[model samples]
Target: MITRIFPSVRRLHRRWFYGLMAMVMAVGIGLATPKPSQAGLLDLIFNGIQYIQLSNLSTQDEVRLGRRIDAQLKRQGVRIYNRDPQIVAYVDQIGQRLAAASARPDLPYTFQVVQDDSINAFATMGGFVYIHTGLMEEAANEAELAGVLAHEIGHIGGRHAVNQMRQIALAQGVAGALGVDQSALVNIGVQLALSLPNSRADEYDADQRGFRTMGQARYAQSGLVSFMRKLDERSGARPEFLSTHPDPGNRVENLEAMLESEGNPNATDGLNNSAYQSKISSL
Candidate 1:
């Protein structure tokens, strides 16, 4: 009986191995040969594995993935502030203004307020931006808050998160093979959005892009620079913004130069500090 059981087990293992090899070969061939529909053989395998490169993710794919990541973030205990509808609406209003003036305005943008008190803001792919309640309170005026939101939108416009995902996949030796599984990619995205510091080049690009967006939206250009200056002057531990977004050595100076180059360094659109504070008094 024992001998018979051992032979059957060996046969079962052999069958499983051959089956896996066949599936892998089929995936390779399907990838090599283009299909008419974007969703083809690749979509059928492994519960809908996306075979495309991360950098080339379509707008729909990016948005879908972002939704998944956002859901997971909520599940992981990142609370969304919903106690006050007005606060969320106000933030969304400012974010929408900046996003409309952004380079990629066609993407559906969703701005959420995080309940946390940390002075940090971040953007994931597919036009999802989150601003902390603390960050809102920290801002002296509406433009300062808008500056942070615009910076986050700039990240989405630049597709910095997608680029970072591709680089991480390559470094992990999975990109060259079957590409990352969708679930794994989503996990990676969550980690990147939460803890990773963006590359120095990406930070500078975001700042420049955000500056332009802010100006285009007619928000006072000084808001961004002033906010950064205020953060830079803070003592004690670095703020989450400074920690997550590495200071590009001279971020404040560069932003000031951009304002100077625009030849209107004194634009005062969103600089009413008293009104701004009154609006956010509930928080």
Candidate 2:
């Protein structure tokens, strides 16, 4: 054994060891101070995914996204022609009326019609509810359109997108939390939302809102169900709209249940096959 190692020299190693410990403690304290990040790396990633998927967005941002989509339709030469401003006004009137009674009235609800023949109606961010000429043509009457718009409004008023976005943000990474760009999120979120089945929770909420709006506004709640019922029989027989807003064959049943639950006729919709077709034809 090398007793040649003196005790004094050996004690010297202790000083170095103590210094190293102090440095590590300083690093730990610096980390604990929490300057900006409240989440760990994993937390940040999870948040991003949670939010961008369908959850956390402000009303202002939502309206902005809707505006962007409206602009895009214009740039793409999409037809948004409304031959009769009254018809357009009628649609907005219905939308506004129901929106006033929705769960999230703070949303900026706006309704528009696109003169497209795709048999499609979709809801965009903010509160943009779009009914395509094709959708109007297919609907038996205004109540049908009201039902459709009400459902879209439900999507906005329920804050479905906002809640979905929060989940996505949680799943996203640190970079996502460090000021994630919303433009990219909407572009990405739409894709995700399109693929993923709208949660039963959302479907249920929209169902409630749609039926209530129709009933309260004196529109035909049954028309909402009727439109969905015939999707299996229509020429398109289930448009891309289904992918965005899926209903597993219980649409009428759901509406009926809602009506039974509500105990009244909210809206009066008698299907006018010829009238609907004529109005849409002008588009």
Candidate 3:
């Protein structure tokens, strides 16, 4: 009877040991697992659901988003081209003309050139459009520069950034963006400016909008096509503009389509002036 009892007691001990080890391993996995912030899974799920229900942003929200991006730009030490008021004014004048012809003509557009030599340009929320000095130098004439500006203005007019921001908020689970949390705007600004580019669809929409604006503003529709051709020729080793804008060939094709639909208007509607060349050369 003693031996039989001893066997039973050993079996019980072995069972208990195995159970304890299993429990320890479960707890170890729980400790090692990476969690999403302090918000936990439930909060992230709720935030994502709430964001999905949101439709349109208010005008005030758009302004706040722009201000946050402007702040970030300043903090990043991006140099604004201001050495020559004449050159600056010239670029702004061209931008203003395009904006006047854009769908959202009432928006207060602000066009600025950066001192960087890289051939790139971008537009953010609100009416802010930035042109790099290198892009200005690369453009063959005033019309070519206008083509670039109109494309950027098209992005602003179409609220493409707003669409991009909505996507970012959903992916990252910005708890405050769906509510009154203003800090979320700051995060959105940084991500939009530094990381994300507009989707291919968005790029195509901007291309169409710009073509219309150029035609309405009498900027010579060929300006866009010509500029794209030149851009394609020089696009080597991953251009900065290519990161944001589509491939130059695709853009050129789109612009040509617009021209074809419009009965093929003269490509030289806008021409370069001596004053325009002088201003560019001085830089």
Steric clashes per prediction: 0, 43, 0
Q: What is the lDDT of residue 42 in candidate 3?
A: 55
- Please, what is the whole-model Cα lDDT of each candidate in the order they appear? 0.87, 0.68, 0.77
Reference-based TM-score of each model: 0.82, 0.68, 0.76
Q: Pick the candidate with the highest lDDT.
A: 1
Clashing pairs in 1: none
Query: Model 1 segments beyond 4 Å from truth?
Result: 1-46, 50-52, 263-267
Ranking by lDDT: 1, 3, 2
Q: Rank the candidates by TM-score, best first.
A: 1, 3, 2
Winning model by TM-score: 1
Off by over 4 Å in 3: 1-54, 176-180, 263-268, 273-275
Model 1, 25-91: lDDT tens digits are 9999987776766454445574655655686689998999999999999999889999989989999
Against the true structure, candidate 3 reaches a TM-score of 0.76
Residues 70-177 of candidate 3: C-alpha lDDT, one tens digit per residue: 778868877898998988898899999899999988777888889998888988877888899988887877888888898888888888887777667667766453
State, as a TM-score between 0 and 1, how close model 1 is to the true structure.
Answer: 0.82
Compose the digit string of candidate 2's lDDT tens values, residues 80-182: 7578886787678778887887776777787887777766676656787778777777777766777788888777777676566556656664224345555
